[model samples]
Target: MNSQARLLDKLCANIAPGKLEWIGLRSERRGEVVVIDQAEAVVGLGLVGDHRMKKTPGSARQVTLISSEYIEAICRHTGHSSIDPRLLRRNLMISGMNMNLLRYQRLQIGDVILETNALCHPCSRMDEALGKGGTAAMFGYGGLCAKVIQGGAFSVGDAVIRLPVIDSQERLFP
Candidate 1:
C-alpha cells in the first residue's frame, strides 16, 4: 500500500466510539444555555433552538461538540474544583472517546449523521464563562465543529459511533 493509504488506515484504526453525556442549546448568542435531554439535528442547520443553528452559505461550522474528559482537564489546569459543561457553549458533551480523532471523519450520533468540519476554536467568551485563564486553558482541547448531514433526533444517552471513511474518488471512479 502507498503511504497515503497507510495513513488513512491508521486514522480509521483510531476511531473511538463514545456516548453523548449532555446537551445544551441557547436561543441567542451569549444567551443562557438550557440543558436538554434530547435535541433535533437539522440538516444544513444545527441543533434546533440553538443560536448558531442558522445555516450560513459556505460555512462549515454547524454544530459543536466537546469531550467530557477535556472539561475535567480544564478544571484541573485552571485550579477550579469543578466546571459545568453547559458553560462551554458546545452543543454536545461526549465522554469515553478521544474527540480529536474525529476530525475529518463522519460520525453518527443516534439517528443524526454529522461530518466533522474543523477544530472548534475557543473565543474570549471562554474566559467570561470559565473564569480567568479559561481561554488559554481550552486552547487545544476545545473540541470540534461538524456539519449536520442527516437530520434526526438525538438524546443525551445516544451512542456516538465513528463511521468508516470511504474515499469518494474511489467510489465515483470505480
Candidate 2:
C-alpha cells in the first residue's frame, strides 16, 4: 500500500474532461498531455499505441506513469520541493488508479469509449520539461499514456468507467 501521506495528499479520486477543461488529447501512437487551451490534447489519431511515439521503431510502449515513489524520490534526490504532476505535461493527472486495473478499460469523452492501446514512457522531452537529467529519473515513473480507442467530445466532470470486456487488475498499492 502507498504511504499514508501519499494517500492523504491525493487531489482527486478521478477526473473527467470538462466542457472547457483539458482532458488530455489522445490519438493512435502519439499523445501530448499538456495544457492546450484548457484542454490536455492527446494528439495523433487512428493508429495503435505503438504506431505513434516510437523512440526508435518497434518498442510498442507509449506513455507510462512515473511511480509515486520514483517521482517523490527524484524530487528529494534533486533537492527540489513542491512538484505538481499536472505541470509535468501529463494529459490527466490521476491518483489512486492502477495501470493493470485500467487495462482494457473503456475511456470516454462524452459517450465515446477510447479503446486504450498501451502505456507511455518518458523521453528527452521529460528532461526538458522537468529539469536537467530529469528524463532518466522519470523513466518508469512518468504516468501512463493511452490512445483514443474511441473518440468524441469530452469535458471535465464526465464519469470514467471500465469497459465490461476488460478485467479490473489488482490495485498496485492495495
Candidate 3:
C-alpha cells in the first residue's frame, strides 16, 4: 500500500467507538416514530416492529442511523435552533463518533451486527418535516444506511462498535 493509504488506514482504525443514544421505529410510511428502549435486529430483515423490515425484505437500506453531531450540523445549516430525532425519522441515533469514517464497515451494536452500506440521503419529505430547506440542509448530513448481518437484541445506551474489514481504506473513498 502507498503512504496515503497507510495514513487513511490508521485514521479509520483509530476511531473511538460511539454509543447508540436512541432507537425508534415507524410502523408505516409517514407514521409516527415510537421511541423504544430496546429492539431485536432480524437477519435478512430489520428491527422486528419496523415496517421497513417488510418493505424491502433483506435490503441494504434496512436500517437508518443518524449521529447527533450531524443533526446539530443540519440544524445550523437550516438556520434552526435544533431538530428532533423523530423529525429526522432515522431508526438509530448515535453519538460520540464520526459515522462518515465508518462507512462500508460492519458495525456491531451490543449483540446485533450491521453492515454499513451507504448514506441515508435526505428525502423530499424533509422539506415538509423540517421546513422548506430541510432537504438541502440534510444533503450530506442525513446519516447512514445499513443491512443486518447478525441478528440479536440491542438497546439504548449500547455501544456502537465498528467492525472493520481488510482494505477498508480503499472502500472508504469509493
Candidate 4:
C-alpha cells in the first residue's frame, strides 16, 4: 500500500469508542419520537418498535445516529440554550464519538452490530422540530444512517465499538 492509503486507513480507523446515551422509537412517519431505555435490533430491519422496522430489505436508513457533540453544536448554531435529543429524531444519541467517522464502518453495541451507510441529512422539518435556522444549523452535521447487520438487544450506556475493516471486501462483527 502507498503512503496516502496507509494514512487514510489509519484516520478512518482512529475513532474512539463511545457510549449509547439515548434511544428513540418513532411511532410513524414524521411522528413524535419516544425515548426508550433499550430495544432489540433486527437484521435488515431496525429497532423493534421503531417505524423504520417496516423499511424494505437492506434499507440503509434503518437506523440513525447522532453525537452529543454535534447536538451541542447544533444548539449553539441555532442560538438555543439546549435542545432535547428526541426532537432531533435520530434513533440513537451517542456520546464521545464522531458520528461521521462511522460512515461505511461497522459498529458493535452489545450484541447488535450496525454498518453505517450514509449521512442522514437534516430534513426541512428541522425548522419545526428544532426552531428557525434549525435545518441550516444541522447542515453537514446531520449525523449518520446505518443498517442493522447482526441483531440482538442493545440499551443505553452500552459501549459502541467500531469493527476494524481488514480491507474493502470483508468486515467482522460481534
Global lDDT scores for all candidate models: 0.83, 0.44, 0.87, 0.85
Comparing candidate 2 with candidate 4, which one achieves the higher lDDT?
Answer: 4
The candidate, 1 or 2, that scores higher on TM-score is 1
Instruction: Identify the runs in model 2 with alpha carbons over 4 angstroms from their true place.
Output: 1-79, 84-87, 166-174
lDDT of 2 by residue, 58-174 (tens): 222333333334457557755568566544555544333444345334445454454444555566776666788777766656655455544444445554554443224322232
Across 1-174, the per-residue lDDT of candidate 4 in tens digits comes to 556545645787778799999999987988889999998999998889888898556788889999999989998899988889988899999998766567768889999999887889999999998888899999988899898989999999999998776666453222
Over 4 Å off, model 4: 1-6, 168-174
Worst 10 residues of 3 by lDDT: 165-174
The estimated TM-scores of all candidates read 0.89, 0.50, 0.90, 0.90
Query: What's the true lDDT of residue 151 in model 4?
Result: 99
lDDT of 3 by residue, 127-165 (tens): 999899899999999999998889999999999887665
Candidate 2's C-alpha lDDT? 0.44
Clash total of candidate 1: 0
Top-lDDT candidate index = 3
lDDT of 1 at 101: 69
lDDT, residue 70, candidate 4 = 94
lDDT of 1 by residue, 1-174 (tens): 456545755877766689999999989878899999999988888888887876353356888899989898899878888889888888899998887667766789999998886889899998998889999999998999888889999998889998875655221110
Note the residue pairs that clash in candidate 1. none
